[model samples]
Target: MTPLLRNIVANYTSQLYVILIGLAVVPQYIKYMGIEAYGVIGFFAMLQSWMSLLDLGLSPTLGREASKLKAGVTRAGVLKLFLRFLETLFSFTALVVVALSWILGPWIASSWLKLESLSPSDVALCVVLVACIISLRLLSGIYRGGLLGMERQVVANVIAVIAATLKSLAVLPLLIWVTHSILAFFLFQLVGAIVEIVLMRIAFVKALPSVATEKFQWNLLREPLRFGVGLAFLSGVWIVISQSDKLILSHILSMQNFGEFMLATSVAWGAYSLISPLQQAVLPRLVVFFEQNQHDKFVLLYRQTTMLMAAILAGVAGTMAAYPEHVLFAWTGNLTVAARAADILRWYVSGSGFMALAGMAYVLQHARGDVRMHIRGNLLNVFILIPSTIALTLKFGAIGAAITWAVTNLFFLIFWTRIVHKKFLPEIANSWLTRDISPALLVGALLCVAAHQLNWPVSSRLLSFAGLAVLVVATTGFLLFIQAETRRIMSFFLRGIVKILCTKNV
Candidate 1:
């Protein structure tokens, strides 16, 4: 299989595992540890994301550099040397971040957090453990980048599946035999990180054994660092855009509400996770495409992928929005949480779905190594989002925060599309709105309406959800892929498969 197809396959396989495991585990976590501990867990999850800022964009930049090496634009020796240098830089950075988190743990537990059940000491221990886990995860990004650069996605994802299984299932044993300790919860995650690091290191070594002899040089860092600076800034801003809502909500909402909102946020962002395989698989190739001056192919790719993403997200997000209570209840078996987060989930997923669709445009920008537009867009979000979210949340609570997110993404989508057309791909400017985004919006909205009318009781949830799934697939397929050209392509593939089957039968 092609690298892109392999990467997508591997990524989807990993995500499917994570989703299934998460569905099974979330209810157990809530059942055993209570909502208060789940809040702490959510805090750790948030910090894990925030820790990406420490990467300084090296992971992505490394992928680009690795792709260049594979394409013969850079020497393997140079790439190997640079990888060692990055390891040194990342090690030092991880130490500093971990130390800082450790020092600040007490202050966060005492001042910022509002947990009623857990002691400050226990919270502190959880914080420190989470810090360690985040540090290890951040450091692991280097190896992950190395693997992806080598197009070892299948190997990388297999390791991830094993690590995730170990982490997600860790709490069950802890809750059963050991105490239902939050510290133990994070301890398991830390163990998973250790396992992931060992496996990732093996994968990297196996992919590039020449790195063993490659000397680390300070001078080798200059070029990648220069390219990485913009990316680092963009990453910092993007993190702020994505996480600022939850950070703000943590203080404003009660612990129980915050936990519920976090759950809703998790479900919403899961939409992004579903679409990420496309983005990850496409990034390395964007560089190659640009270098070869394949503008026509690039635009075609942009349109096709955007349409595909929009169709899929629309269906998923729309269904989630339309039947959030049902979906959440099914996932958690907690009617209280389902009721509390229903509207928030609806708004958050709907917005996140669109943002994920626009992420394709961001991928194109990142691949072209022109991050100024993304930086500008994210800056706009920071300036507009924080105040708007705070005001709306004060007036309307968690749902307001959800609305603020959705609105911000709407504006960003418009801004991103304008820039993409004006500065990047003007050829499709006229048709983009009508041909691309509009159809996606229509499909999503129509499906959401269709789902809303179904009103199936929770008792029949399996059949109801099954019906929803059928609606999603049928709607998305007809709108996105049932065109004349797509039909022809499908027919050709079907004929090829049939011929192979007939030959085997003979």
Candidate 2:
């Protein structure tokens, strides 16, 4: 198959399988663990979010560098160099994380949280699992990054499918037997991690074209790593910003509250994960276009992508905010927790939609090799994201904390746009601001106001959801009709679909 076809299949299949498992396991987690237990689970997940730093940005850098030499370079040589750098950097970072988790897990539980319900041992068990999972994650990065750089989504997706399926399906039955303690839960996950790595290795071997090691360019390691380290710092800070809210809550609020807050945030981020398949499929291709200095083409595609992302996020976020009870109850069967978090969902999903814009902007910066600017933008987020989170958590509880998280992105988006102009394709980036972004934010705000007001007078879940559907459809239709740019993008995307179909038929 062609590379484009291959990437699409891989992204779709992998994301689909993962989503499948997520659907099965998440409800079980909610039912069995309760909101407080899920909160602990969320905290562990965030702690491992630090592993993004381990790759720095080398995975993409590896893919870009490797792609430039595709027909020209030796695969084995490229693979070897990629491994050497990734292992060294990952090992160092992973050690620090494990050490801190070992050292600090108890202190955090006893001193920071000071909850009688949670003992030092409880936090320690979570930390240990986190460290193991972090190591497995780094290894997966090496394999997946190499595959992605090689644009071997077909193989990567299979591995993702297997791992996600196992995690989502296999664990449920086992959890039934071992659901007594946190250690058993972590053990089940740790074993799943091992199974995932083994599957990923087999997939990589099968997908790769067998190239010998004769063309080893050990020297490429030096400069490529320099780029990778920059990615590490920038991506690391971003990791902290996106995932730290839960961890911060674990620190400030009780673990129980943190879990509920984290659940709401995870539900909001669903659109991001759903849309990510498209982003992953296209990203490596963007590098090739960037290498060709096709700035106009890149900007054109970005504009179209922005509109599609906005449409999907708006529709989904609107439905979610409008019928939080309907959706969350269906998904997880926990109406009490879902009801408590209804207002927070309205803002978090909208904020996540905005965050998605910032993330795409970051990806553009990555393509341009604008590392310093990327680093600067993320560093600024730490200052804004952390303080806002603490202040809001104290005053507003979970809902306030989420709004603070969202507002920080609004702040970061302003700086990110400026740097895009100064550093990347200035001309296209300039018009990009209002053209692609404004529709979603403008319409979403109007929708949120309508959703919030509808919470009353209906006095019932079923009627409230009906009101939400009306508001969402009306808002979306209004945008499609009035916004010329939104229409243009939808038209272009649909046309591409038609062209692909015609080519297949012919």
Highest lDDT model number: 1
The backbone clash count of each candidate, in order, is 0, 4
TM-score, every prediction: 0.93, 0.84
Residue by residue across 304-324, what tens digits does model 1's lDDT show? 667767777877787788788
lDDT, residue 339, model 2: 77
How does residue 3 of candidate 1 score in lDDT? Answer: 61
Candidates' RMSD to native: 2.5, 3.9
> What stretches of model 1 exceed 4 Å from their correct place?
209-219, 451-454, 484-506
Q: Write the per-residue lDDT of candidate 2 for residues 1-506, one digit (tens) a residue.
A: 44665576568667756764675577677665555666677777776675556666776666656555553433455656566556676778777777877887777556766354545687676776778788877777776766776677777787777777666677677667656455666777788788878776666556555665444465757667777778778777877777666666677766777777776777787756766776766676666677777777777666665666666566767677656666555555566877777667766776777778777776676666566776877787788777877777777777777788667777766567756665676776666667666776667766656656764542455655566567657666666646676676456556777888999999
Candidate achieving the largest TM-score: 1
